[model samples]
Target: MVADDSKMWRTILKDLLSSEGYDVITAEDGLQAYFKIYESCVDVLISDVIMPGLNGYQLCRILKKDPHLKDMPVILLTGSADSVDRFWSMYSGADAYIEKTSSNALDNVKKILKNFKWKSDMPPQDGKNVFGAVLDELLAETTLRAEISELSNHVEDVDYTIQKIRNLLRSLFGIKAFAALMITMSEMILYSSLKDMKKTEEDLLSRLKRPYFPSYHTYRTIDGKEDVEGLNSIYKVISYDGKEEGVLALWRERSFSVREEKLLSIICEEIGGIFKNIIEVNEYRKNAYLDDLTGIANFRAIEGHLEKLWNSGKNFEISIIDIDHFKKVNDSYGHEVGNEVLAGLGKMLREFGEKHDVFVGRFGGEEFMAISEKSNFLTSVMNEFRQMVEKAHFSQSMPTLSISVSAGVARRDDFSSYTEVIEFADGLLYQAKKEGRNKVISYESIG
Candidate 1:
């Protein structure tokens, strides 16, 4: 018996096994898989782990717990090469976890099915076709045995995962067009392989209207409903632990068969889990570059921004800002009040950064920094920031009490590297403080 949401895989496997003269059955999702397994005894169950109502793990657990079906060996299929996914398969009591992308997917299925071949005394005929090419040697078992940490090089962000799925479907199944919608830890991402690129989300969502799948139960009992005419596409909603994760919509000119439906479902489910892990990785990445108090980029992020500028060979004007007599403000009020001042300023700076298309972040203590593409008004931006700080009241303790900031502006042409620009800006900033408390100093004026 084979149970997967992908109709493509289901048809291929069923045909392969049937040709070998083995009676075969198929299911589209876990709900259908459960019924198909219980209806009549089968040799071994090959099921895809991620499914609509009941997932592979859920199905395996339920079967393992049931005394009647406990002896039935189960083989689980996954699309992700992630170790977290491997751990999940192991915990589910599956006899094997086959990665769909591995060249050995079909070979592994044969080996697993043979291991659990029922009480029959005779061996089932080898399912491989006489004309089919021989199975290639396992390539060091990468689809599973490879270290998951090595994924850092492969898994960049949700886009990497999204494009990977598109590539896999294209390479393996000849699926040329599909749309994926996912929301990861940092942002919402949308991708579609449709040629037009102009098709809106409304168009994709419209595809789901009119009717639910012709018959959801057709997946469970392969005998249920015949294929609907002109319906060559399939849509599967990916989720984890009862929460909505993402949706995949795909279409081909040919109508999907029972086998392909099961395979596609399993693929979508595996992608959901992969996306979840990616979200966690991205969150960690975002945290490492974020300031704890100011909610802006930290010094580490500043370095990255400078590296980007250097790589792009772009020139910019920069400003370094310092709060006037900040220590006195902290000493007079309290560190808590000082924090409030910084947070308020950070908020205002973030808005200013967006409005002016500049990079802004706290530079430790009461110092802040900004850099933008060269423009005559760069000086005005810096002075405007200083004036805004001077007029702002940070504390409720003394509503009328205000603070001021000093700034120094420098153009990138005056310096070769970020370190040089920063040094030049810092020198001018101190010169301003020395001359007077509230003042904006230009790099040219210092010389």
Candidate 2:
């Protein structure tokens, strides 16, 4: 599968892959590539990281978890040479990385395929197995190890990026403390999504309606509302083929001073490249650990994260939250609204969880989990979340709705394993529903 937002690049890539005697499938974005994987057998995925929906990293993570597709190799194309770019690409599960502008891009791709083919042709030892069995096992192991190593390295890169972004923001904004704080918060959100390591478009007229980064002044004014007015500066929105995926906004306090606009343009160019790289890395990672519909961490991924946290001996709180009467919601509102609610809840969790050291993800349909480092602070946060949901206003075309969630919280201690912790939290969640729907229950009380 070859996924990119650029028609020219897609055409060029298709031609290159076909010339090598490989079957080629093309998609304009990550979402389309995802559907293609389900519909067909894709031996390899060659994708651009940044697309409108289901960017490369997210796609990659999703693919990695599939038993059938986990062994397939992935190559990410980007225009960046930065350590952040390379690290993320590897971390996100890319087997190989190439710079789009490199003269040897095609040659490098050929080399990757050649190596893959060589491994795929390895002979089986003994008459006990089929010829393809040995090669398949070898490929799968090699790919799995590569993904683990890549994820470790990517996590380190995320740490480095957080630091670098913090410093860069401070230096550029000249508001040391404030810049550091803002950058830290921004990095937390960006890196969290990136670390989930998991990781498109419309026409020009439609594109203009999407959200964008505004000039610094405009950002300040519009911080509280959804309105974008008096935002004099230009904001760039990435369009693939013709569809809009997402927008990147750069802010200046005022119109360019000196040749600042030119400098800013250069910076934006670098950012654009970084954005592309990040998306690619994320897609590769996503192929490893995401649920296609809810866009949350799948069971495999959540278990992996839980084990890591427990083994690391970190102090944290885990909560299992489920929508009260979710089946009824689906029956009453239709599956479409149920999906919307799930997606909406995920977004809300992300937004609210930003206030603390929280990791929120959809565990499955109508069930989600939140992990936080601060046990003492959780109740207040949970209460705030409850209020937020209670007051939330949904689209009016839908039926009148008053929805609630049941939550059970558990704190990790010496005896906890990921399984025990999850089971305890889940039990508590059920208890909450038994006591009363729409209330928070703590595991300690049950113990």
Candidate 3:
């Protein structure tokens, strides 16, 4: 979700997300945005700090107060550099604060989204929605318990640091107080990382039901404190079923300490548990809908998705791609080599299709399908796939092999069933093979 008063900025942001394959929702102001949030689910919220009818700060406060919406990541974009402005943004519950003039806003947005977790359902609200009320309840009961436990342990070390400072101050110069202050600040930084981790875990658990893996690394500052040069600390929540999920990395100018390490470990463990749950859910979904070998949408998944989209009254193009002389290759290279080629081709198609919003999947042995938003681009994407196959370099030890694919693309302006579009595309693909291998033939051309 993008909320800004400037129509130009809103359009620009929306286009950027669209180009990157995201379905975006836009609002002109904070009030409009609050209504949207109430009505829909948004993965991330990007708001301009200064807006009419509930500014970004007020918006953040409202969201953070709401039990149903507080878990959603809110990023505040400001054009201000004043220390007071930064403090206000933070105090208002903004997860991240960025300058509007900074070229890194987009990067920061990406980072926030990558780490964000959204809740699936919310507890019923009673009276006026208060910020952080439900989250405060949930955290106290679950997430905060884990965090507080970790913090309690750190408190002991902080006490020792205080004692050491007192002794140093009396015996040495009066610099002991400053030294203790610095250590206290470092510990606070560690506490913030841990808190963020717990929130991330809660978000993932609420949003996903799949098994996931969690990994973490802690870095210490140059003075052997809790800062790291490249990373404050890194936490990654990965789906074990092979999908990239959430990654949260905080960067500071220094390194970490023993207390920080313990806190990081606990945070990583909590995050990993949540990820594991998501992965498990994904695995069940995958088993029901994915091809075991190619890892593309299985026939069932593609058919279902296509049906849904078709029924939703959206226009789409479907194409069938067949490997040219694939049987002959299998016979010449044997099944083992043929399987290798199939896997290699599958990977290539996946990577190439990423930039084009094309969904490429194995329809069956030696045959594949690619769906694209633009029917015209289907032919070009297939053409590129064919050229890549023709120029591919196989294993050196095995016999040098070359292969090509023939594709047929079909587009529909009118609503049509999935079967109709697929059949049309398949017919075109057959024509490509019949005319000559390695060519893209379209239904329009054939008709």
Candidate 4:
């Protein structure tokens, strides 16, 4: 019986074996193969490792436990050139293991059949059932542990998620190194523990170009033996939202055991959800720092920047701006029109700040703030901004109604604390309003 999910592989193997004067029975999956094995007087079973319902290992374990079928030679075939697959096949009580990609796959299978035929007269093996039972028990324990780890894990960002995954892989497999390559619509990010990211990326991309296996979770291999810390990497493509999103690669000196491979599959299945949650968390964080009314930085975000700049002892200039007679505008027009006016002014200020390499945000009510590195042209920049506001029209519906602003500027060098500078700028703003509205006030004017 030849069991494989792929129709092409089943047909090719069945024809090849039938030509060797052996009647061939084909099954599409492990479950179907098991039932067919019972229905037919099968002498040999050739099955692909990765199949739906029941995998090759599970099928072999079941066959080895049955006294009637335990003596029948079973050959496990896999697309992965990973030596671990051969170990897993033998542990599952298969008589022989063959790589489908091998040039000698046909010769190897024929030789195994010839050898097993000679030993057909011998009695059935006695210890295979015991070993198979032990393998199943070990796999169950590993699966339970992986499930508990997944349930308890909570990650806030992509970096944290990757780190947690790395730690888990290391603990589970004693991996030498681990890496990830994530491709989004806007960017491609690569992270590796080995530090040689350029070389790792080059080798990973090259190996990914190799032929893919025909299994539910296909793994491709480049060579038969372990290469270095990173060259002999085994990677699984992460897919979500109906497309390939990333690659997770792992390297270890020792080959992964059968139980570890199963656990790795479970990890691959859940990683897509982890990445999706991280993206959502980032979007939530970004929105939290943005102003809803102005669609710019909120006061909380501004405070964070101020704290950073003050702690670093960097010299920067701050401008506190207020709209002249803003209450009158709100009284004459409704609050809706006042909101539109605020939003329009915010858009203008944000664009101007961006053009001048300044940081701007809405302070509160009808007030706005701007911060910039201390420069020789600071006073001129403030004057130019005031003049622009005086000449500009804010409301398109009420274009004839003009708006003007008053600003007070202060430098970080003159203040003991950032709060004091804000208070001093607010006082200067009051001074500008006291003398007359629609003017810019600074330390130089008061001095």
- On lDDT, the candidate that comes out on top is 4
Candidate 4 local lDDT, residue 334: 71
What does the lDDT read for residue 223 in candidate 2? 19
Question: TM-score of each candidate?
Answer: 0.51, 0.44, 0.46, 0.46
Tens-digit lDDT track of model 3 for 82-158? 88889999999888898878888777777667676665474333322433443454443455336433443333254
Error of 3 at 354 (Å): 1.0
lDDT tens digits, residue span 1-447, model 2: 899999999999899889989888899988777766556556788988778976777677666655565778888888777778788888888888899888999799888887774112222223123223434644644543443333333432544543443344335433212110011111212221111111111111133553333211101111122222332333444333344333434333444353344333443343333444454565666567766665557777778888888778887788888888889978987888887777777767866766565877778778988888776666667767877877774434564676788788888775437778778888888888999788888865666
lDDT of 3 at 339: 80
Please give, for residues 280-310, the per-residue lDDT of candidate 1 as tens digits. Answer: 6756766998787776788899888988987
At residue 135, candidate 4 shows an lDDT of: 60
Ranking by lDDT: 4, 1, 3, 2
In terms of lDDT, model 3 sits at: 0.63
